[model samples]
Target: MRVVIAGGHGQIALRLERLLAARGDQAVGIIRKVEQAADLRDSSAEPVVLDLETAEPAAVAEVLEGADAAVFAAGAGPGSGSARKDTVDRGAAALFAEAAQRAGVRRHVQVSGMGLDRADDPGMDEVFSAYLKAKAAAEDDLRARDLDWTILRPGRLTDEPGTGQVHLADSVDYGTISRDDVAAVLVALLDEPRTVHHTLELVEGHTPIDEALKRI
Candidate 1:
């Protein structure tokens, strides 16, 4: 399968690229900086420079052409403010989905957060809350699209070695999943169309990642 990932330079995105490449699948990384192409090359994935914040839907669709699937994995990052969170996490993600619709790509996946449920509480003015809200909006946009979509909402991400074990639930459940394991789950979902039109909450668990994915 050919996969295109937005915010290709992100850690989890890179890990996903490597996994796809190792499996002899085509992985395309959509980056903002042309210079970052070198970073993606080392992972054996083609890199297409694209600034989601500025790129029009047609321009984004051009990069998505001929791709089998697209993953919305971009974020404004820690140094960014609430406005950027909305712009990149929410607006950019919506733009990507629109572009995918225009390009006729039917399969899409979005990486979201776990705490977006109560993100709008008056007392929850924290940056993390804002981030969750942005993710929630992104998920909503993807869900509204006329395409097969899956939203993976993982809890606190850790850099720890992947255990290849995860808890996959149809509803919000767990609160911690490794980036590597998340990548593994995404790849598994790509192989199973049954997982389409589903939203899953993931966290590191005792079950094998592949086995847990089967339960979904």
Candidate 2:
């Protein structure tokens, strides 16, 4: 199977690419900078240089042609202002969804924030609030589409090694989860079509990745 990933340079996205390549599946990463292509190549993933921030849906669809699935993992860093949150988080996610439809790709997986409910706090930081709103908007957009979409909302991400265990549910604790484990879950979700149309939250737990997805 072939999967197209947005934000191919991100830590979690790169991990996912390596996993797919290791499994003998093709991985295509969409990056804004041409230089990141080398890094993706090193990880055994093909790279497509497309700036999601400015690209048209038709252009994105062209790259997604013949792909089995698409993953939206792009983000504007914490240091970035709220406007960028709207552009990358909200705007780019929507762009990918539209492109997925145009490309006739029926399956999509969204990597989103855990406990975004807290983002609704009126006193929250403006940037964080904007991110949550963007995430919420992305979720709404995907849920409304005709695609077989699954949203995985993960807790505070860490670089620690994966335990291959996690808690996947509609709501979860605020514990941290490793980027490796998150990638494992993404791959598992892609391998399991039964997980379609479900929105699950993830964090560290004792259940194995496959088992957790199976239970879902």
Candidate 3:
């Protein structure tokens, strides 16, 4: 399979690229900086320099053309304020989905976050609230699209090694998940067409990754 990923330089994306490559699948990563190309090459992923925040949908579609699947894994970093949360999280995500449609790519996987239900809670930090709202808006937009889309909302992410175990379901209590485990699950989701149109929550658990996906 040939998969194109937005935010190719992100932690999860990089790990995913390596996994795909190791499995003999082609991986293309969209990055804004030319400097990141080497890293993608090291993972055996083709790197395309494009800034989703400023690029038109048609331009992005050009990059996505002939791709088997697309993954939206972009995000504004922790240091960024609320404005970027809207631009990158919500706006960029919407743009990527539109591009996928234009390119005739039917399968899409969106990397979202848990706890979006609390986006409107007054107790949350202002920027965090905005971030959640952006992610939630992005999820709504993807659900309304004419595509085979699966949304994975993973709980607090960590850099710990993957245990190859997880809790995957339509809904689950909030918990933490390793980035490695998240990438592994994404690979399984890409190969499982039965998961289309489902929104799943993921976190660390006893069930093995493949078994967890089978239960989905």
Candidate 4:
């Protein structure tokens, strides 16, 4: 399978690329900078340099051509303000879905966060609030599309080693999940046809990854 990941240079995206490559699957990463291409190459993911924020849907679709699946993993990062939140978080995700449809790729997986649908109070930091709102909008756009989609909302992400175990549910209390584990889950979701059209929440748990996805 050929998988295309937006924000290809992201921590989780890179991990996912490595996992796909190890399994003899092709991983394509969409990056904005040329320097990031090397990192993707090292991970065995083909890098396509294109800025989703500025690129039109047709341009993005060109990169997505002949791909099996597309993953919207891009973000504006923590340091940016609320304006960027709208552009990269919400807008970019919507654009990716549009390009996917135009490219005729039916499968898409989104990396979203938990509590985005209900978190309306970003009083202390309007930026964080805006981030959640953008994510929620992105989710709405993907759901509206005519594509095979699975949204994975993971709790606080950590850099700890992956346990290959997770608690997958439609709703769950707050908890932390390793980035590696999240990547593993993404790969599993891509392979699990039953996961189509489902929105799942993930966190650390005793059950292994495959079993957790099966239960979901």
Q: Say which candidate scores most in lDDT.
A: 3
Give each model's whole-structure lDDT. 0.89, 0.93, 0.96, 0.94
Show the colliding residue pairs in model 2.
none
> On residues 24-116, what C-alpha lDDT tens digit does candidate 4 reach at each position?
999999999999999999999999999999999999999999999999899999799999999999999999999999999999999999988
RMSD of 1: 1.3
Better of 1 and 4 by TM-score: 4
Worst 10 residues of 2 by lDDT: 114-123
TM-score computed on alpha carbons, candidate 2: 0.98
Residue runs of model 1 more than 4 Å from their true location after superposition: none
Query: TM-score of predicted model 3?
Result: 0.99
* Prediction 4 global C-alpha lDDT: 0.94
Q: Which candidate, 2 or 4, has the higher lDDT?
A: 4
lDDT of 3 by residue, 143-193 (tens): 999999999999999999999989999999999999999999999999999
Best model number under TM-score: 3
Candidate 2 per-residue lDDT over residues 121-176, each given as its tens digit = 86898889989988989899999999999999999999999999999987777888
Off by over 4 Å in 4: none
- CA deviation > 4 Å runs, candidate 2: none
